[model samples]
Target: MSKAEIQTTGFFTEREFTCWRERDYKNFYPCQVSKQEGNYVSLSLGDMSYRFDDTIAEDIARCILDADLVTAGKLYGYIPKPAMRESAFDSWYKMNSSGVWNYFGEGEFSYYRSGGVIIFMERVTDEDDTAEIMGIYTIDDVGIKLVLESSSYSFSKLDAVWLSNALMEALGEEPLDFLKTSTM
Candidate 1:
């Protein structure tokens, strides 16, 4: 067994140990890694001890580090309310108050709100009529603003993805495969 030490920063300083196996399993197991203080590393399928070479260990460590950074940055993968515009709030409020604007254009549409973030999804009547995420908006003291627009990469899609997952979890529905209609 090979072992390596990993150092991480932010919030606090910590040391992590990675015990590696000589053989490669072709896939990283225990798919989900834990963040329980000292238990920061994930193990492969065959061992109780987290085993991986420095390369794999570093990869896992990077993921853990990134997650920590996201948390530190207060970016838990969703639009923050302070980032929303008044127009978006009005639109959302109108839809919710009357419950009559659920359908728009050629397909059905719905919106989900959590914290300060709002996600809009639509099922277009075009060729690929699947329900696709349209945009992610945020509301704050400054009003509402579009945080993630489906057609461009100017914004982080991770927040939108997080919102979508949250929606699915709340509705007890299967994961939805949102179509990317952006021609760009």
Candidate 2:
């Protein structure tokens, strides 16, 4: 949220992702590295949190990173970037100009797990047109598919970035640096 937080939460380091995975799937308490006691590293997720020894902490991190790579892969696929600028622009214009805004033209990227795999779906609707891209990945396979609900429309990359950042934050990471511009 703050500049400091952004600096600390920059793109998923293997360590951060591992930490997130541990917390999300294993229900390991989220914690920040604090101090070290011989072979053990102390961690505190929050006030009144339990401290873990180094061995347990390492085990938790390993479990988190070891979780099926499907979810992580899907997450990576949703990072909207320069390549998607044109599509994003087109979608924004259509949504704004079309009278569909009165009835629909809403955009959303919903994430959930099904059958032990993670699914990330982007649904956008405008009047008679709709575009949906869904990313489904599991430990064994990964795929990104387009499902046309009606006519056709483009998904907004900006929306994708927003959704991606939201997911990262939800996983205890910092917001993305996609839009940040250096003043110098």
Candidate 3:
């Protein structure tokens, strides 16, 4: 009935509590992060959390045993910068009246998967129509294709779920209920 409330802990009470974030305000959804005993950092989206180890490799772990531990932007690729989105409507809305056209148009995104299966999305709106649009594609040996549903993949169900959750968060879509997937 109401907006969902985010949970926090004494470990996350400070403004310094958030995970890696994009500098722009409208850039990305701010998923929460957690760490304990300096072992790993978990970037969580709803019930799905991706664990990234914070410790160095065992081969070099002993080299910094006595040094003061610090968080020197240690979380980068593990928590990437949110994908940026832009639209022609944004430019026109900016160039036109600000009062009545404040929220006049909807996004028209172009979603495509790269050769490596990495997804990329871009806004290509051309009108002020309040029509929302998006596309979903499956990447396979045949390359990108519009499929009804994506079920099978070369990766595990757990990785699939994590990627789904991350993309949803990045695109500002609702997080699906398939949160707990087995690592099998």
Residue pairs in collision within model 2: 22-64, 40-54
Name the runs in model 3 displaced over 4 angstroms.
1-122, 127-135, 138-157, 168-174
Model 3 lDDT per residue over 10-104, tens place: 12211111111222342323234343344433344333333333321110111111010111112121211222233222211111242211101
Local distance difference test, candidate 1: 0.26
Under the 3 Å rule for N, CA and C atoms, how many clashes does model 3 have? 0
Judging by TM-score against the true structure, name the best candidate: 2
Whose TM-score is higher: candidate 2's or candidate 3's? 2
Q: Which stretches of candidate 1 lie over 4 Å from their true place?
A: 1-47, 75-184
Error of 1 at 82 (Å): 23
Residue 107 shift from truth in candidate 1, angstroms: 36
Q: Give residue 26's error in model 3 in angstroms.
A: 38
Candidate 1, run of 10 with poorest lDDT = 10-19
The model with the greater lDDT, 2 or 3, is: 2
Clashes of each: 12, 2, 0
Write model 2 residue lDDT over 1-184, tens digit each, in one string.
3435534544221112122223235332222343222443322222322223333333223222222222233446431222222121122111124221111112233334445323333333444433333221112122111121221211122222332333344344554535432211
